[model samples]
Target: MTPVPTAPLVRWYRTSLAGHPDGLNFRRLWVGDTFSQFGTQVGLIVLPLLAVSVLGADEFEMGLLATFETLAFLVIGLPAGAWVDRMRKREVLVVADLVRGLALLTLPAAWLLETLTFPLVLVVAAVVGVATVFFDVAYQSYLPSLVPSERISEGNAKLQVSQSVAQIAGPGLGGVLVRALGAPLVVLLDALSYFASVLFLLRIRHREGPIRRSGRRLHSEIGEGLAFVFREPLLRRIVATTALGNLAGSVTNSMLVLYAIRDLGIGETGLGLALSVGAVGGLAGALLAEPLLKRVGEGRTIALALLPALPMYVLVPLAEGHPGQAAVTMIATSMAITGVGVVVYNVAQVSFRQRLCPRPLLGRMNASVRFVVWGTMPVGAFLGGVIGSRFGVLTALWVGVAGQALAVLPVLLSPLVRMRDLPRGLDQHA
Candidate 1:
């Protein structure tokens, strides 16, 4: 037989294996990430519920609790990125998970001792927030090291699917458990999930590169990351879009449980069921993202995905005076639609940034983007609380939805709208 072009076949083989589970350390990462996401999803519900239902926290205090959970991203966000770069990302992931698990354990312990207080909840939230900052930066930075550049999108899709699945099940599970076992005891499950994540993480065998130290001042290192993000027009725009979105989303989220339980008279089961139903949209988004990106182009996908959800948010505040079942349905519908946009936007934007940055700057770049985007969360949460407390929860929802409507403007006006595909290999523009 004639030579079958060995070189081409070898190249094709490598390409075929790029995103497959067995080809890299992604399988273990995926498993660990799933557990972590499940824990986080459950915590998202129970933590706030623990404060509101158990400790009798009002709207402003609820906002404060939300602020504490995200406060670390604002305070240590920039420095955490620089720090992650100088350390083994895997180690950082492991340590972050460990810290979160331990801190979460304190909640159940406090509860068992009958010493559970809002302040204790706040402290634990703050600790978990700090660990989460490190974990997020490390996890994003670590993915590029684990998979080939071309397969980052695939890896992200799979990870997002896992997160989506967790979202789908977690709230309902948390509700049932909280109702059955009490919210305090339910926290223990979230803690256990984090521990499970650690075990899965330890099983990964992918060796990361030795830590690279610049021996430079911390501020300077941070500045480099900031500079990279700001210097790129597209990245800067994406940051603005996401920051605004987070601000709006946090405002709404901070008030959502309070509004649902108090204003709408949604029982725990109804609230959880609504949130769980909404997560189905996230799963759909994750599954559809790749194909949508291929069809619409990555940049356009980011821009387009956000628009459909703008009006969807209006359905939320508008549900205020409806019957309980109708209100819950409206809330679930809004969540499901918004969840789809959020997931699709995230998968596209995150993959684009990962592909755009050099490997060394991955940690800093991810951190910088998150710093800008997530930093807005606490501020928004605080504003939500203040607004909800002063005006009314329904008014706060209206204000939040209005902000969500405007958040799309940044990306819509950018060159992303005109482009068919996001550029690759360090090129910031199409």
Candidate 2:
């Protein structure tokens, strides 16, 4: 297949921002992304709160909610790539926003009708997950087309920083709203955020050409992409390690809030504040990633970032304070350190992926990797629920945090750790 024309990426900005002409278009995309992230973070806090508070969902139910949110990555991850490569990505993003918005809207509607149920939350979570699988695939693919290759790291950093900012603000605000209006109504904010994203997407003046599909075999294309990922040594290691990391992280994340409430005795407002404190680390990591990568190399940066996460993670189960000293000190420290590690690892790995892949294969390459890497989330979520149900939530968290440190093995054992820099040319994959 020939390289698709991505000139439309430039048309969106067609101007400058903060006195930087080169980044103007990116700023426009950034604006929409920032708003969208705020909404997502708000929903992130509110959704589970609704499940716990309104529906009285147990650990298994809460875990199931998390499962559905990521199940689509495993189910249609490959096919979505094939579809994305054949359609206008901008349109996919818009539709995804609308779908997520509509899906979230149902919760408030259900609440008004007094028909909201845990099962309904599960279904909507699945729907939103499906949309996200496509949106994220397209969003990653679309970025390479928008910026000069040299600036990819900058673009990613800006986007991540904005997301971190959202993390900082969204949860606190959502918690306040959840406390003020109740969890069900708090979802309305998320729904509106999606609509806001849709409007921003629609306002872009850029245009994309329709793909020709006369002789394309979808499976063949999907296989081609998958082959590229699994066959390449470096890509394989990254994919493997990421999958394990996510699986382990999900195990803890699946039960984090519940653990906070039960074990730590953290209230809604306090829970949000705890999460916000963590985002301070995320924000710091985003700001530091590019500079760190430049100094230490992607491999070293990843190693340094990830090595601390597990040790920090283990401290979470030990948090003793309810709302004051122990809660603020122990739980907050764990989350903040983990957040830093995650962001740094993400920025380095993502930048490496964008720099390494060929432009023509961007969408499928991203999807294939996403499939293998992200596919573990639901499994992990389910396991977390089972472990929490059978043994205990604290036990599940311990097992999860322990496994997180081991996720570094694949990359550490591979050639990635030996390098001072990522290979800019595909021929240097060795």
Candidate 3:
């Protein structure tokens, strides 16, 4: 891995914010992040619902929409990291937010004007997808710069709480807004969320110098990030586990709503409730993560979180009932478990990555990681669609769930299993 150039940061262990120990800068970042993410969650639901309800998209079209939504991770994931490293993280984040907001705003306008087309929806999805590639990479990279090194764990844990809260709240809020104002109006909420995020980001007073240009060729820089990840044993392990697991997850996700509504006899309301119930587990995981990590250590925490979800995944495929009320309970339980496992693992590993990698390479490293890990999602969604259509949705569920279950094996056998704490280097900010 390439070494990061260490920058000095303030120690924030003694501060109090509403009785919390984190600093004001982190609070600003978190608030902005939460607002944007809440909007994102709203957008995520409203867009697809609109696709089906307003655009009259079929299963195939929904699959394509899912693919386009994440395909940017594979397409621009690497280079975006490189560009992010050459630019101010805040600027990159702000521009990405603006782009996403503007792209989404077009949807409501087109719908109001009665000029919305299915292809136009796909274009909007794709554009947002591309901008997200940059936003996400910069977002992850920005954290270590905003807080003390020792506090990165707390920062990550806190951020996960916001995300988990969003997961729990965003969908329900979105549903209500959709019901009150309709789908297009619900999209306006997301567009406005981006603006809200921008407002918070603009309020952040942290400054950055001109991007340190390595003057290396873009492809070479991209390759360097990839090589760094592939070369390091821990990162390599993380990527493999996440990539395969997410691939399977994408399959389950792609088919979940369709199967619930079409095959399992569950209605949209039941499906929505099941998903909402499932998000509670994420909130729990985020809240419990610190204590869990304190007791179990990082490696085992990562491993244990995902391990339980393996067996829990079976309930989804075996779900049965008229309206699948019982099945819905079973499925929601499974999602709850999956959410806990995923959130804990995510929070722990993000802190680990921030600690392990040099600051200068954080953007590229995260981007590279996302490239390999998240890139598989689009493929998995496409595969899920193919498998569900060909073999039946239940069969597709098994394949996806089974893949997710098996992905944990790589970590159990690797160096990650034995580590008590993540290794930190001199390049880290302290």
User: Number of clashes in every candidate structure?
Assistant: 0, 1, 1
Per-residue lDDT tens digits for candidate 3, residues 1-430, read 9866443212233442312544677788889889888987777677777776677665566667778889999999999989899999998889999999999999999988999898988899999999889989998898888777887888888888888888777876776676568789888889998889988888878777667878679999888788878887887888889999989988877777677656776655566667778889999999888888888899888766788788889889889543468987998899898899889998888888888888888888999999999999999888887887778778888999789867888787787777778778578755
Q: All candidates: CA RMSD in angstroms?
A: 5.0, 6.9, 6.7
Query: How accurate locally, in lDDT, is each candidate?
Result: 0.90, 0.82, 0.82
- Give candidate 3 regions above 4 Å deviation: 1-22, 320-324
Question: Can you give the lDDT of residue 244 in candidate 3?
Answer: 95
TM-score, every prediction: 0.94, 0.92, 0.92
| Candidate 2 per-residue lDDT over residues 314-421, each given as its tens digit | 777777444555675676678788888789989988888878877667788889998988999999998998888888898888889877878988877777666878
**Which candidate should be chosen as best, given TM-score against the real structure?**
1
Give one digit per residue, the lDDT tens place, for model 1 in 25-64.
Answer: 7878889989999999999999988988899999999999
Off by over 4 Å in 1: 1-24, 426-430
Candidate 3 collision pairs? 4-358
Q: In candidate 2, which residue ranges exceed 4 Å CA deviation?
A: 1-18, 209-214, 320-325, 425-430
